[model samples]
Structure formats: C-alpha cells, structure tokens
Target: MSEIKKSVFDAMPQDLSDEFFELIAGNDEVKIERIISRGHTSPETGWYDQAQHEWVIVLQGEGEITFADGRIIKLGVGEHINIPAHCKHKVSWTKPDEETVWLAVFYS
Candidate 1:
C-alpha cells in the first residue's frame, strides 16, 4: 500500500473560503484532521456542540476559545486542549496574518 505524506503548514489554496479543513485519517469511531484558519471565528450567535470529543493542538499561529461559562483560553504554537463532546464553546479569534495550523483528533 502507498502512504500519504504532507506538511501541515504547507501553503493553502489561494482562493480559500472562510477557513479550510482536511481529513487525514480515521476509523469508524475516531478521526484525525487538520484545520487551517486565518482570522476566523465561530458564529456570534452559536456555539459548537459536537457529538465527538476533540483533542487539538496548535502547530502554528495563535487562537482564543471562549466557553459558555465565560472561560477564555488562549493558545500559541505547541499548545493544546481537550474539548469534551457536547461542551458549548466557540473560537473567539485567530491570528490574521499567518495560518493557524491545528492538528485535531476526534473520537466518540
């Protein structure tokens, strides 16, 4: 079998939309993906309530996450967090000039 190899910080599409996500690998109950963000934030009126748990690490740039309970978490390169499923949270801000590369593993 062949293998796939790529850089998480590689250049993104020149005409990308709001943000970009790429599926790397996964199984029936778990998944791994890469999220690339630049000046992106969650919707002002909503928070993410996912069905799967997420463990994420930032590989580049910086970001902030706010929880429903008024908790704000800041992350820089090499920082990480584990978000439980169904937890209400939203991305508050992201660095605008550089790509914020994230490595995330999601599981039920």
Candidate 2:
C-alpha cells in the first residue's frame, strides 16, 4: 500500500463558496474535515449544530466563536478548542482581509 495519500484540499471542488469544506479522513471512530472560511462577519454567517463531537484548531488568521451559553472564544493561529455534539455555536467573525483556515476533527 502507498504510504502517503493526497490531502482532500490537494484537489477540491472550486465551485464552493468562500466557505469550503473537505473531508480529509473518516473511519469507524472519527471523521476529519478541513475548512476554509473567509469574511465570517457577513450577515450570512450564523450558528451551527454538530451531529458529532468536534475539536477545531485555527491554522491561519483570527476569528471569534460563540456558544449557546453565551461564552465566546477568540482564536488565532495555533489555538484550539473542542465542541461537544449538539452544542450550538457560531463563528462570529473572521478578518475579511485574510483567510480563516480551520482543521476540524470530528469523532462519534
């Protein structure tokens, strides 16, 4: 078997919006997705509910995320946090002048 495989973003569907998602890994235990989101402060940006447990880390740029409990976290490159499944959360804002890259790993 080949020891290396191309990452999902190595070749992704370009037709996606400024916010793009690519599944990078999945198995019986976990699923990993990479996200590229830009200009998150737009009126269109809002909250989300995850079906599975997730942990996300900022790979680039800066942003803020808020939880249903009204707690907010400001994240920048190299910072990471975990979100439990079904927890309501949202990306409040991201620098429009820069891209916000996130490495999100989800597990059941």
Clashes of each: 0, 0
- Where is the poorest 10-residue window by lDDT in model 1? 9-18
Q: Output the lDDT of residue 104, model 1.
A: 91
Per-candidate Cα lDDT values, in order, are 0.90, 0.79
Model 2 poorest ten-residue lDDT run: 8-17
**1-108 per-residue lDDT for model 2 (tens digits):** 456966534654444356777777788789888887777553445568878888999988888888878998999999999999999888888877667778999988
Task: Show where candidate 1 strays beyond 4 Å.
Answer: none
How well does model 1 score by local distance difference test?
Answer: 0.90
Q: Every model's Cα RMSD, please?
A: 1.3, 3.0
TM-score of each: 0.92, 0.79
lDDT of 2 at 91: 83
lDDT of 1 at 87: 92
